[model samples]
Target: MFLSRCPLSHTRSGTAGSEAPATGETSLGDSLGTFRRQQDILTPAELAGMSVDIVGAGALGGAILLCLCKMGFGITNTLTVTDFDRCEAHNLPTQWFRPSDVLMDQAKVDALAEMVGWVCDRPITTACDRFRGDESRRLGPVVILAVDSLRERQLIWNNLRNREDVQLLVDARMGAEVLEIHCLDPRPSRRGTTRPAGPGTREFYEESLARPDEAFQEPCTHRGILYTTLGAAALVGSILRAHAREEDYPRHLVFDFRNFILLAHGEGHGETQF
Candidate 1:
């Protein structure tokens, strides 16, 4: 729900059978008028100057992209999307795509960028190759990892953790029964200290490697568009909340889709592994 506002504040309210005043038709001398007022509600200037590099344009990544674009994030945010996968027939039910988009001669990132370009107008930079090579890496103030592979997560953690400029990193694992959100605030010092700060330095990585891979299966055997969408919405909210606030929120959160429970970690937490 939107915030309630007094109509006397130069914002005209429509009567029972009358239409609201259109833009440029308002007698008020306000430059932005109501639009600026709404922009004040949740201005995305914090995300304006930052370049956001996203990996894995699958269900989770696609949802995040839509929310970010609708939030009025600048196109110049240097959007770099990389995905080697293509949209399949089965993906049409769970992932964001159209029948017309099916079997297109393009990668997932390319197809998504094309769809988003209609809203953003500016073309987004897309890479068809997997985000594996050193040259394929990009150091941004914020990096989003929505990939499904454990090895890929380890690689990204190793490459981006020690950078002094990178402020935040977020990872989401939306499984069938549970949705896990992992966040990391890259700083030299934090609550936990298992390792020294430097390149290839992450205590969480060492721990995760010692353990076996955690097995998971989809909750609903067939893709449920509803659950996928709901999880996506929750993930996007967390991302925007982190950016809008002056400080970070939690380092980890989990949502049990079966029981409908949401859990968050305490503050001062360090980097976390999958």
Candidate 2:
């Protein structure tokens, strides 16, 4: 649903939309009118200087990219996407891709880069390699982890935890009907969590790893839904946007889509593992 709203880039000849409306193109001045009003929370200047690197280009990452592009984030900030995965037939339902995309056999990051280039007309750097834990591997100042496996996520956190350049880290995860978004900004002396501030990531990873039922496919499998993916990505984008503006929201956020309950980290907020 949210993907429908992203104004994407298009090649003049092979573009998706052939017709340019009689109203003509909307100028950045007209499209960016909302930013001027939200100057208190997030101004264009603040978002301009930050560089964002998203680890995975799946459902969550795709939505986040589209949202950021629509908001004109890449106008000044550098947005780098890294994903080695390709779009398959199964991804058509949950991810933002057309039938033609599956046949192209293109990398997820490349496809997104093309789309975003058309939308914002901004250059998007893409990497077709996995994000292995490397201390010297620097994509940008901010990192967003949307990878599938637990080990991969932990590896990234451990590598960039103490790095001086890393300003923010956001991990977006989802279960059958719940989505959790965790943010971490490390300072040498000041700390928030007991350890590196995983926000239930360690517990969730261990439980999923030990679950015997996960070995065999059951009738009811834990898969991400299109609606849930959009919801989750919106929350991730919102949290990152708040982080850029230095606004106060939540260090950890868990939302229950089934019950329509939203909880933020605090005294009563439970750190539930997926």
Q: How far is 52's C-alpha from truth in model 1 (Å)? A: 1.0
lDDT of 2 by residue, 180-252 (tens): 6766654333354434324433333234335433432323355677888888877877776766766655667
**Candidate 1's residue-wise lDDT over 1-274, tens digit each?**
6322212111112121233233223223222342365464455444556666677778778777666655544333555667777777767766666666665533577567666655433334566666652443445566677787666777766656556656666667666667766655654454254234321234543354334266344445643455655576556555655565655565566777778777765354343333
TM-score of each: 0.71, 0.73
Colliding pairs, model 1: 176-219
Q: Which regions in candidate 1 have their CA more than 4 angstroms from the true location?
A: 1-38, 120-122, 187-212, 218-226, 268-274
